[model samples]
Target: MNISIVLILLLAGAAFTFFAGNKFASKIALLVSVASFVFTLYALNLYLNGADLSCKSIWIQNPKIYFSLAVDGLSLAMLLLTTGLLPLIILSGWVTKFENEKAIYSLVLFMAFAMAGTFLAADGLLYYVFWELALIPIYFIALLWGNGSLEERKNAILKFFIYTFGGSLFMLVAFVYLYQKAGSLEIESLYALALTETEKTWLFLAFFLAYAIKIPLIPFHTWQANTYSKAPAIGTMLLSGIMLKMGLYSVLRWQLPITDTAAKEFMPYILGVSIAGVIYGAVLTLRQKNLKKLLAYSSLSHVGLIAAGLYSLTIEGFQGAVLQMLSHGLVIVGLFFVSEIIFNRWNTYTISEMGGIRSQATKFASFFMILVLASVAMPTTFNFVGEFTILYSLYNVNIGFAIVAGTTIILGAFYMLRMYQQTMLGETNTKVFADVTIVEGLVLLVIVVLVFFFGLYPKPIIELITPSLQNILNQIN
Candidate 1:
């Protein structure tokens, strides 16, 4: 079967899960997601064994649009990340009760469909459609199923919606402009356009606005912490684990190639902002008392470094960015799941309210400690591999930039360790903190194992993504 089958299965699963009703909705959703993941693996095998996975068809003759989908090493890696995490995301919420549980599960699958589409679509307009489609499910997921006071949730969700939606309009405008000038909206056509520096600069900034807000870089990131805090664990997982990657992916896939000259011209400034965000996010995390918000801010810091690597416009930079995206996605989900487990036990997210769980629940604490170390980029974890590569790329650009960005490791370790101490260490809590349940243990184990496994032997992933990154670098150069 073609790669499109992955999308078809997920969209179909969403519909079936919605109709399956609440009693079996989660199970159905999990099954469908797993099926899609398996299909994606089959697709990857086909791709690896020298098969062409791209498909294209006419949609709008006048605008010259096509229902196009393409797969290469880069897109395949993202597809794997998306499909791989979906089953875990589903399982993370398995026991949590929600209003209209079937609907929640349905939305999750639908979001997956959109995300997979976003990764696969090769036509510019088609990509835009999938990009915006992803926002709808998450909006509802956060709005309806999120926690916090009604007004707080409403305000946070609205801000996130407005920021992302507004930013995307600029990207849409860029796509329209590209279509007008190039007479086609396919990615290759946009890349081929011989635009003037002035035109390329405008187009680059427009696309950057969309991606930055989605990546939520710096000033654009105001919506993130509150939204992460307000949303339920599952919603937060989908957002942090998969959604933000769309923006970073787009940077490599769409932005830099289409605006290569402009990207080169603006590299220094953009790198400055990204490195600044790294420090900014890490510092902010140091002050957070709320567990979710702290993790949220930490994500901001990590992604900033990833964005910097992409902007560095080197092969190592691209590889590091992709690797970190996967590493961060898995580790963040595990951390959020841990936070959810704590919330389930204590019914609170306040850091000061937790302590000494290590004494009672060694398994839970061990899992958490591993995830924490991964977050801090411990030597043998995937995070270290990704972060070291990224820092090395930055050092190639400017030693000062590398030096500044390196602070993330130290600052990350400090705040992350401090947060771990307050939340998982200290005297034993009076409340009984049970060890991880079987399902929870399985989830954490998978994440931790993958983290270390990739860290130690990154050859396969490096080899998988190298050619795709080299192609993008060629386009940029």
Candidate 2:
């Protein structure tokens, strides 16, 4: 195992700041997060060069517990998203005024460590550990920093925790069952163990339950809107941008191959659920008054489309799902961050409370409009590339499903344009609305460039993930 040591360095930096004073603490956290971001890039470079970074250490030998860390093309892509987004999240947190800056900064860094671990861990138990570890920091972040009724925020966090954790228990059972069969906790070992049809069926359901709740396919998604609305913007960014991808990634790493038969057998039903979610979420977005809730539903709708693509059970669908995952992550992070800007200046998130920012700040309105367009899958945006691929892939499966999925384009435009118009156009509500700050403009500009860059030329990412995607697709019976 050739260790990258980036994780080690990040954890070390976090540990060092345990006793640091308030003034320098945020600075320390910021520097460490930025460093981790650089190291993440380095890790990606290593992966691109075909260097393998797999390491394992025995943690609980009697129970066969082991700490395993590794990265592949898929995992590397997620790791890059996780690390790249952290610096921005950290910066966003910094721009906000917090009462306990030290604790807030420390908690954010800790959250970063947990997220990084989630992407890097290879052992089932280790992955679960990192998976649960992520919830703790975020729970606190929401409870302490969220702008909402205290009890309501607490309840939302508690509900979010309970729902996800409850699903994970079944996942734990599935892993234990696999351990009994494979005699090891390593993912690769478990992946190789042949299971009877019945066993695969039950294990797949267990895995599906966990991931479904997380990606939050309909009926299981009650916690998403409330949580996203109550939590701080950065918290919403983390949950939507990268954490939700945990489920999609698991579909590749665990579900497709291990439960190939079950997946194939139930493909239509899964696709149906996804389509329902897409429409349900979009229609609900049309009725939302809060900007955060609107974005939450929009994300739900987008994830549904990705899930539908994954269930298409073809190479095109699989690759499109992967691309969509990356595209969505980047787009949501930018959108939520921009929301933070709007909320900061206007001191409100309700669309009804905002009007006529277009004349006041053309630059701000323009950038927000770009993000809006990206969210709506406009041509020359990353979302367009992802959605096109998914639609094409769906066409291969069933033209009907593809046709249904295509409505998202129209639905998305309706809601996004409506959102922009309500918030940025019409009579000026206040005489004091200011343009985006320098830091804010830079952040928006960087995201906009990335949105168009990936949209115009996605071949590089598609090419990078091709080999691994084929490997996963081949495992599908």
Candidate 3:
């Protein structure tokens, strides 16, 4: 199957949902998400069978780019992440009382469409366009549907918008510069670009600025907590669950090979920044009163280590990062949706106001406990394998770096257990507490099953991803 159909279906789905009116829009969107996901699985099978899935048409003449799209192991893994979470995202949105339901539903499909394009793009300008295209739908979703005072919402969304948009401009400049240097924006052509050490360093920083701000690494991460806090829960899922992976993916795809010498030159400092962010994010999570902000901060800590693994430049590191990206994407969607469920039932976001959910909702507590353990990288969950691989890679790089980064294990446990205890274990704060409805249970059950399934046997993904990372490493050399 041509992967372009996946993009076309998503875009078409968006338009159809926009005009389908309120009553049917959400259902149509969910159906479309599921259908696209099935096709992705087909595409993955075709790819493994040695069928060619890459296709391109001339997109521009003078600049020499194509509307090129292709899927490799790396791209397919990320594509799975995008397509897999989408149905769950849509399912979670079903509980939301969105104003202008059609617009919101349509925007979501548009976001998925753009992210899918990003993973598959075989051309740099095409990748950039899709990258920026993703920001718009989420922008409106946060600004229009988010819960906050109008001014507060505006401030948070705008910071997120401006910070990310500004970073994207740098990435555009780096691409443009590379295009001018190589006379082509095709991924392979740029990968083969010959630049002086100085030029590559500049390109490295330019791309890093973009990916860091998007990933919101460390100080660049100021935008994330506020934005995640204010955005609607569905939007939060898109951001944490999938959007953030774009940076880690970009590091593997764009920054690492293109800036090989520069990356090696600055490897110590770069890894230091990443390790610092891990500690920084975990520290901040300890004090958050708001549940969304806690998850947002926790995401930072996890991604910080994931980014560090990619920087470690080992196949095991890359393999673990890719798997963790998928695992984190699944777990975060369940986490945010749980927070949303809490808010839906109790009308509160503050931790102090939550308690005794376990007393009434054993099912919720069971599922929630699994996710909490997953976040903390417990065995028999997907995250444990990924986290182990990453820490092992870091240990190879430097024991001290590994030690610092390992703090996430402890810190993740600390905050997650505390949050679970305060929210689910203590005395009931209100009269009513309900078990997860069927839809919510269904979504989280998928997450739980996948988490365990992958952890027990991650060999398939590791084998698929290792060759791609090897290819990238070959390019870097």
Report the Cα RMSD per candidate: 0.7, 1.4, 0.8
On lDDT, the candidate that comes out on top is 1
- Answer with 1 or 2, whichever has the higher TM-score: 1
Which sections of candidate 3 miss by over 4 Å?
A: none
For residues 86-189, write the lDDT of model 1, one tens digit per residue.
Answer: 99999989747788989999999999999999999999999999999999999999988888888898999999999999999999999999989989998888
| Weakest 10 consecutive residues of candidate 3 by summed lDDT | 425-434
lDDT of 3 by residue, 187-227 (tens): 88888888899998999999999999998798799999999
TM-score of 3: 0.99
TM-scores for every candidate against the unseen true structure: 0.99, 0.97, 0.99
CA lDDT, every model vs. true structure: 0.94, 0.86, 0.93
lDDT of 2 by residue, 371-458 (tens): 9999989999998888998999999989999999999999999999999999999998765778988778777787889899999999
Pull out the clashing pairs in model 3. none
Q: Cα lDDT of model 2 overall?
A: 0.86
